[model samples]
Target: MQQYRNKLLGKGCCGTSYTQVTEELQELIFNHVNREHDRVNEHRGSETNPEELQELIFNHVKKDISQSEENRGNLRMTSGSRALEKHKLPSFKNLIDLIIDDTVFNNNFLQMMGGMTSLQSIEIFSSDISVNNTLFDQGICKMLHLQHLEIWANGLMGTLPWCLANLTSLQVLDISYNDFMGNISLSPLKMLTSVQELRLSDNHFHILVSLEPFFNHSKLKNFYGPLPIQPHMSLKELDISINSFHGHIPTEFGAYLPMLQTLNISRNALNGSIPSLFGDMKSLVFLDLSNNLLTRGIPEYLATDCTLLQFLVLSNNSLQGQIFLTNFNLKNFLYLQLDGNHFLRKMPDSLSNYSLEGLYISDDHLVGTLPRWLGNKSCLIDIIMSKSHLEGPIPLGFCQLESLEVLDFSENNIIGSLPSCFPPSSIKQVHLSKNKLQGQLSDGLSNISSLTTLDIGYNHFESNIPDWIDMLSNLTCLILSNNDFQGEMSIRLRKLSQLRLIDLSHNKLFGHIPPCLNITIVTTAFDFVFDSHLVRIIPLREEESVEFTTKTISYSYRGRLLAYMYGIDLSNNKLVGVIPYQIGNLVGIHSLNLSHNNLTRPIPLTFSNLKQIESLDLSYNNLNRKIHSQLVEL
Candidate 1:
């Protein structure tokens, strides 16, 4: 094999003044590396691990490119997105295992792997690999020694090739999250008697013929497929979730899978009652049957039947009954999720027995005061009890949860002042919106210095926005709308440069819009707020909007397309003044609402600078004259 090596002799003559890389150059390098990796990995199946190959290529490219950049000296630079080229492979005969993720796959890549007959494991994920019926005839069937094959999230289409049955030596086969449609025959899967694990979930396989094909596979340890299963002793893990499997769970499920350790049948059409025999599965560690139609209360036997269970999730079911935790062996329990159910009981006192890490029982009819015993679980990290009808004050004992990170009590009737029990500097996200919480914002909130989001909107909070809010340097979102707050809009808000979204509308405030709310200051602060809350709201990207009563309409923006945005809403307030000319300095402000305010003056000429403004509402204001021609163009 030919070897390629290049050594840099010394620094360039202009070493003291090396040129900083331009965005264009960085993007060019990124694209080059990505294309090269794709080409190489598609052609070569090598002894060199894919990760090592990437490092070798990067080191080689950086060394040769850095010296050239030094010669270019100073140049204008532009901002660019970050990129990471996936590691790749080179042709080598004896390669055993290949795992590639988050890379676009093509037909050539498949052809390259087809030649690697010695491979034992092959896993590809989050790629664009298209697999049709011919995939097996081309190369996959060549891997007679293949033990494990997983190709997930690759947009695979067409029926699974029957030739898969030829790979009888297969132990594990996972082909999930693809576009495969129509009914799939289980006959081929049945032939793989040596298979230990199988996952065909998240595909469009409408109906599976029978569980008889799987019954004979005594070596099957993990199964995630349609059709009711008569489990075997070797089966340890099973997940048949997000399917159309309906009817009552078989009472003998525990007896069939005697050694089962993990079971998840959530988000299915399963109805009827949960099998009490599930508690008898001694070896089971994790159980999840959430988002089902199971009725009646939880079986009391579960507490005594499964001693080793570490994770139990039964949220989003129709189960009804007073939840009591007596006699439950919760010593080994780590997580408990009973949210979105019809359990109309108070927070169970017995839940405090275990040292749990997560507890989510939201959207249920749990009444009375917040459980004080929750403080005993010092190891608790996440607590989401949103929309639960729990009333009264938050317990002071909750502050003992020093490891807590997420706390949500939104849409509840919980009354009283904010509790000071939060573990200082530990919480990251707090949602107390749409509650009856009253009184001034507590100084205790300042203790949680790590808070990134704070929403206390839609309450009877009668006070001024606290100055300490600016001290929460990491805050990216602050929502205090619909409160009885009365004060002039605070100039201190301008100091919070990281804020991306702020909703203080519908308050009894006065005075001019903050002149410092211009784009220059906002753009500087928002530079660090990219990629923060973009993922969860992607579906709403095109119609990116926030609803307010200013214009009695929802205004939309371009969303992530314009990643850095600035907006201000000061409508329906007791303000009286001319719109500030400084507001025009906010060239990047996308939405500005100042309607229904007692302001008397002509619109400022500076409004012409709002080139990027998408939604501007100045209705119901006592404006004297006609709108500016330049502003009209905007």
Candidate 2:
């Protein structure tokens, strides 16, 4: 077998390659030439172009060039190099950077790459194979010259193998999203005196407390996870967002890490009142104390002194008392998420010329009408006020929000007809479920051809299912359940092939189960989640969610896993006729509920094709011989 080796560069020239007397080995490799990566902007930052077709390696690197379906010339670090022999290649060492991106290869090359002493950067992104423990113990630990190492989202499991004590030359280390479990300590990481940026987010590591270990190493700049309270002068961004951090947030945070521009201590077990000293950190840009056990009111200084603060997320906390006081500056504030709190306020009032973009204060016991000041927020994109006690009609002034995309007033006491002028043209998801709103939905949602989710369920809206409903070509979810609606299943729903979840259940309707309801959005990648439409975040924003009752319980589905959930709930309605055989065409469906409807026919045997079905509810229907034997197998 021919061996693949790295061809290192020396100060703008080709440094060395092994050809004359090296061992004959066969391995897929990226042949990067000196000063040529800039020509291909697609591979601009990477040291080697990942899409190596049949490109020939430099003179001393390789004589024979080959290509195949699996490798694609990616550097595969499989274990046990070819049997050593003379006159072939001695010990080829000069692999500088190894970037294994979306390539089918085992991660056993670490120890092998250790021979290539010149290896500096190793990035393995979007990997599919299991990374074994020898990855650190044999390969990376020996590379004292390696500087940047990133193994993001590669599905690596188990506790971190922290043999990285001698790499003093390392500057950047990112092992985020690896799902590595750990009571991992950063005490060993402090040895890398030259490290600047360390990202440990989305891992399962319970890291060390107190930024005390790195307090002495003056160059650390961006730290992602593992929260500790300590003073580090040069540290600009300190993140302790995902961990088992307990106890109260020390009030001296402002004095400690005085240069911190962004602080994220969310998703922890810490409880206490908001620290008053945070306002003293004059350079603060983003502050996320959300998803904590934090309680009590906001400190006055945080509203007045933290002038540079733009994004504030205190969601899922027990924070109470009045919110968004007049002292709160609105100049640079972009997104404010105070959801899951008990703030006893109606809405933020002392705002006139605000530039807020996304305002989410759901479940805050907010009462009264949505303030008229809301009309001035021209930059508004998401307005979430679900599960509140807001009353009266949606203000006519809401039409002024020309940039509105998500208007979720779900689970509120808001009544009165939706004004024909409401639902601006830019709306994508208008969830007015669980309200007393009454109106012909068509009169309001007529012009919105771009709407994707129209959930007006659990309201008093009454009208025939309009033909224009099918005109919503991009509709992914159409939930009109538990509403007063009389219509035949006459609309052409099959035209909405992009539909993933449909719930017209518990309403007044009569017709055959639309064979077209089985119009499958199923594809090879139907499970892929769409890109989050919320532009700015606490690095946070709500994604689309749908509530469907299945197996006698309502479940709300959202986020990444929700992508694979295909459900159709047409139960509890006045419907009649044979269950269409084509309904079984929804082979990708996970939940199919057709109970509580007045129909008569044998259960379709074609349902046996629903291999992905998780819940099949066909109760209370007048139908059927025994269930299909194949479906019983499911």
Against the true structure, what is each candidate's TM-score?
Answer: 0.78, 0.79
Q: Where does model 1 exceed 4 Å of error?
A: 1-90, 181-186, 420-423, 518-567, 578-591, 600-615, 629-634
Q: Which tens-of-lDDT digit does each residue in 1-634 have in candidate 1?
A: 0021112112221112111222211111111122222221111111222211211111111121212233112111112221122232344356565555444444655666676777777766655455564356666788899998887766888777788888989999988777667665544777888998898877788666345667778888887766554657777887777777878888887777778898888878889987888876888898988888988888877777788988888887987777655677756888878877888878677777778888787878888888888877789888788878887777777777788887778778888887655544588777788789999887878766788778777888887778776677777657788888888887777777666667777888888767675234454434433331232121100122222332356432234532455667777788788888887777767777888898888988988988877788888889976886777798
Q: Lowest summed-lDDT stretch of 10 residues in model 1? A: 1-10
| Per-residue C-alpha lDDT of model 2 across residues 1-634, encoded as one tens digit per residue | 1123433222222333221112232223333322322111121122222122111223222212112222223223222332223222223465556665443344444445456566687776655544556577767778888898887766878876657777888998887766877565544676777888887777777656677767656788988767666677778887777677888888887878777788888888889998888877878888889999999988888888877877888999999988867767646778789999999877767655568888888878888987778877788999898988888888887887899999989999988988778888888998899999886874557678788888989999887888767677888888999988887875587788778888988888888777666457853357463322221134556766778777889988886656777888889888899888887777888888888998897887888888888888889989875776776787
TM-score of 2: 0.79
lDDT of 1 at 243: 75
Best by TM-score: 2
Please tell me which predicted candidate would have the highest lDDT against the true structure. Answer: 2
| Model 1: pairs clashing at backbone N, Cα or C within 3 Å | 44-90, 44-91, 45-90, 45-91, 45-92, 46-90, 399-421, 519-586
Segments of candidate 2 deviating more than 4 angstroms: 1-96, 101-108, 125-138, 141-145, 152-166, 176-188, 200-209, 522-525, 529-538, 624-634
